[model samples]
Target: MLNIALFGPPGAGKGTQSKMLIEKYNLAYISTGDILRGEIAEGTELGLQAKDIIKRGGLVPDEIIVQIMEERIQTDTEVNGFLFDGFPRTTVQAYILEGLLLKMNTKLDCMLSLEVPTDQLRNRLLDRAKKENRSDDTEEVISVRLKEYDTKTAPVANFYKEKEIYHGIDGLGGIDQIFERLTSVVDQTLQKSWINLVLLGPPGSGKGTQGRKLAEQFNLEYISTGHLMRQEIKKDTEMGQSAKTYMEKGDIVPDEIAIRLIERQIRKHPDANGFIFKGFPRTIVQAYILDGLLRKLGSVVTSSINLDVSTLESIKRLTYRGKTEGKRLYDDTDIIIHRLEQFEKRSIKVSNYYSKQDKFEIVNGLGSEEDVFKRLTDVVNKSFKKIR
Candidate 1:
């Protein structure tokens, strides 16, 4: 997902540029002032706290603002990305936002700062005050606002600057010209941001364990096909119903259905740095289809890892797991052997497809879990190094 924080002082034309970028990029506008007003209007708990603070002529605390911002983000899950305006007013808030986004498996792609001369900003605000006849936009009020931005907001630039995601757009040009600069920077930032990985291995090869670990380490969304299908079925979505019909008849869900579900999950997290795909593309045809799907999204598989474990070792692990865990359905010795045999028959072809693209690796999955995880991380780090 493409997430940006728009930074500028008053009268730097942030509102004007924000409108154009929102339409062009399909981003959800997340303005802190709008959220606060909505909360107050709805009389929610946070709203009451904010209202009380306003009644006492006090600035709302940053922690409260962050709490409300997270609530908004959690509730509004359908979007290509987010445009953050007027929230991170301090260096502390910038760090908080980074942690918050990391927790959500996404990261702010950039902070587009509109840089304008003091005289120009003052002149623009004065002209705006005259045109709109806004009493609050008086010279004195604008001065205070600009001072607050300088003292409290301007330092946010340094925070993003250190992260190398800060871009400064000259706020002195024509509206269209400034917008072109913003989009150019945005396009370049997006090109270098995504990290898609697919995990391929047999049932007892620790795909789930390693996939989850890598996703958290790198801030990527983890897509487990079995879990995704179960979630859809629980929600009774149309796609889920269709898959259910096939599954009830002891049939494999068609590749079209699986691909559609995977695409839906991918689009749900437009702000995600990338995805860790587990258990989806089981066939050579499915691998081809997955590649096409990611291509449509302007991404490709960064790496496809096969966790190499012997058949006897896999049997031993599954048997021990069956006695201790008892959660997986395919843990029976006979079913485990059958599943491994089928995977060996079909998934090797899928692995070869990725290998031909020079994006395939085999990590030894023997020994202790920690040892295996180290081997997996080595391959992953190498893949992501090339991506970055």
Candidate 2:
């Protein structure tokens, strides 16, 4: 599949529409703005110069921008076609981008331009400005901004049109309409895009049930770590023996050994974001090690959801699940009581571990799975709130 270049104005909802297209179709979002910033940080000669100009809230020079673009596209793995959200506003940048793609033997598949009316743009910008409390957004600045965009960007639209690679979608419709059109165009253009997102939850807390629902809804791969552990115990590998040692003694496996076991499983499924760590990392020490392992692999838990189920409620759910499953992992009442005691003592200090670092959520895990899910969804939405 070829990479996509999404072109649209400031208030045209390019980000909102692009997110729908990406999630629905599985697209890698490649923003030149992100590349430009990263380039400057590496002090790659060109980045050093752009750093000064951009630090003052001014635009970087065109050559430096294109140079940054050239480096980024060459290195990116196309797990899905890229959606270029903020890029190629000028014809020169577009021309330079074509050369870079040609050198890599890749071509931009489609250029999607969001078309919104001038009046709507004005209202949207003003309302956003007021809500955001931006001092620079006056009627005068907004008017000038629109005019400058027209002068600089209209040429790039015409250029893509001449190449017959541009598709225009209405940006003023109801969100669903805009999103539906965006998805249709992207599916028609690319061969691959979606990815598996797994959520790890403990017994009776609803990870398995809700994860299945989310996977089916998004068409993603689903794998449970607890299931994996059970399978390994069934087979009895070296690490499995290590885990079995603790389980047989009614003790949680220590972090150092448990992490290596988790790492082996992780190496097998590199494409999936990660194994949903349902029961691992129950302590601050484990979370610390997991952080290093994830960093080495170049990703992090997209979010860590703490289902804040009351001690009594958690015990009830766990007890019922253990009895029904009859698996050793769930079958121990003494262990469950011990774990909950550990949870309460560490509650205060645990927040400091995640408060400033991890994408953590403390969802009220007090009620039914359905009730907890409503809250879980809210945390998921907030954590990825910017995805749309």
Best by TM-score: 1
Question: Each model's C-alpha lDDT?
Answer: 0.82, 0.66
Model 1 C-alpha lDDT per residue in residues 1-388, reported as the tens digit of each score: 6789998888888999999988887788889899999999999999999999999999988878889999988776555678998668788888888777755545787899899998889888889889998777878887888887888865788888887888988888899999999999988886676788999988788888888988998889999886777667779998778776654443346897788779888889988989999986888888878877876665667789998988888888888998985545456677777777778888989998877656789999888878988888889887765434
Q: What tens digits encode model 2's per-residue C-alpha lDDT throughout 2-91?
A: 367887777998888777777664567778777777777788888888988888998888877777776665565534446777567788
Residue clash pairs of candidate 1: 1-270, 1-271, 1-272
TM-scores across all candidates? Answer: 0.56, 0.46
Error of 2 at 36 (Å): 2.0
Q: Which candidate is the best by lDDT?
A: 1
TM-score attained by model 1? 0.56
Clashes of each: 3, 3
Off by over 4 Å in 2: 41-44, 54-59, 190-388
